[model samples]
Target: MQDIIGRIGMRKAALGVLALAGATILAALAYEHIGGYVPCELCYRQRWAYYIGIPAALVAALFVRSRPALAAGALAVVGMAFLLNTGLGIHHAGVEWGWWPGPAGCSGGVQVSTDTGALIESLRNGQTVRCDEPAFRFLGLSFAGWNAVISLGLAVLAGLGLQRFARRHLAAV
Candidate 1:
């Protein structure tokens, strides 16, 4: 896998990263909109990396040939974003597994209202999703766990591609 990644040029690698990030975000949106899976606060937060990475990958791809340094920088940023996202995924997964508690807002809670009207309104607007619970799990891994795996893979790919670009272009400069 490392050899294959090392061999893929900067532009191709950037495109690959873009494709993967796009597909993952699209899948998450589909799960939420089409499949009726409501995302908790953390689930929504986990998407930040993909949102940032997609454009960065595109920029990297576009500038790869014209300005290799700029492309390398963009790819490095994408790699770092994915790496941070991987940590977030792992934290969310741990929360789901009861290894640690989730945030106060996302973990399970009800707002106290003394007024009858306020109570009714609060009930109507209450949060339905809890970050501590896994909405779905497959192969002993929840969505968060799968996200961690995918994010780590993306980070590694970006890193490998950056390394290759540096060797081929930066080293020559």
Candidate 2:
């Protein structure tokens, strides 16, 4: 299995990474659009990684054929995206766990504006989505928790690709 995967090379691995990121985004959209899961601000923020990772991975795949160094650099970008996502996931999960407060704009108790007109306007605009609560939990993990797990896995894969690429480059030199 390891030999087969190695033979498949970095391009295919990059494609797989991109595919996973795309599928994950698609599933999140489905959950929001089809399953009626409204996303909070933090949820939306968590998606930035995928938004960046998918295209980056595609570019990496494209360059992998003729420009191995460029492909490796792109993989590094993908890895950074996932690493940033992992940090966000951990922070969000901590928020959910009540380890600390979330952002003032999105989480915590209700706020009443000082001015009467502003208060009325705030009420008219509707409630703000809180970051500290999960819309739903699956298998004892929130969406943020799941994202952490998945993003970490992607980061590891990218790291492995980096390692493999470096080893090959070193051997040739």
Candidate 3:
């Protein structure tokens, strides 16, 4: 692990991880636009991690050469994003597997409003996508399941980046 870190350098690895997040986001968009898969509210929520991680990765990579402490902080944020995404992905997968219910808004539960006109408007503009249903599966894994797997991997990579930064900082000290 140390050899790999030394060979690649944390900055490059951070950039690579950021690119992976961006590519995954693009793939999600493609699945929605080109493959005609409509995203549920949970699906949209799952993307927040990647959206945040990409920018954090950029900052980490940029500052790693001159300001490693700052880079470490940014990498920590990236790790947290992926870690949070992993939990969310697991929850979404469980929802699809009937292990638990998703958010009321996306799980097909009807929300009653005191105002009839507001209720009527919500009904007209409400989301039709169901978070409990998997739009498609590959190798028996839903997209949420895949996201959990990928997010766990990203978390590990971020950990490695953090370790690298720590080692360098300690050595300098």
**Pick by lDDT: which candidate is best?**
1
Tell me how many residue pairs clash in candidate 2.
Answer: 0
Measured over all alpha carbons after superposition, the RMSD of each candidate to the real structure, in angstroms, is 1.8, 1.9, 2.2
What overall lDDT goes with each candidate model?
0.90, 0.85, 0.87
**Stretches of model 2 off by over 4 angstroms after superposition:** 1-8
Whole-model lDDT, model 1 = 0.90
lDDT of 1 by residue, 86-158 (tens): 9999999999999988997778764566999987886789655889999999999999999999999999889
Candidate 3, 58-168: lDDT as tens digits: 999999879888888888898899999999999999999999988887787856789999878877985579899999899988999999888887877888888766776
Q: Give every collision pair in model 3.
A: none
* Clash-forming residue pairs, model 2: none
State the TM-score for model 1: 0.92
Candidate that scores best on TM-score: 1
Ranking by lDDT: 1, 3, 2
* Whole-model lDDT, model 2: 0.85
Give the alpha carbon lDDT tens digit for every residue of 1-173 in model 2: 67754654567768878888888999999999999888888889999999888888888889986999999999989989999999999899888878888887887765667999998888898778788888888898889889998899788777777777877886889
Could you tell me how far off, in angstroms, the CA of residue 96 lies in candidate 1 after the best superposition? 0.1
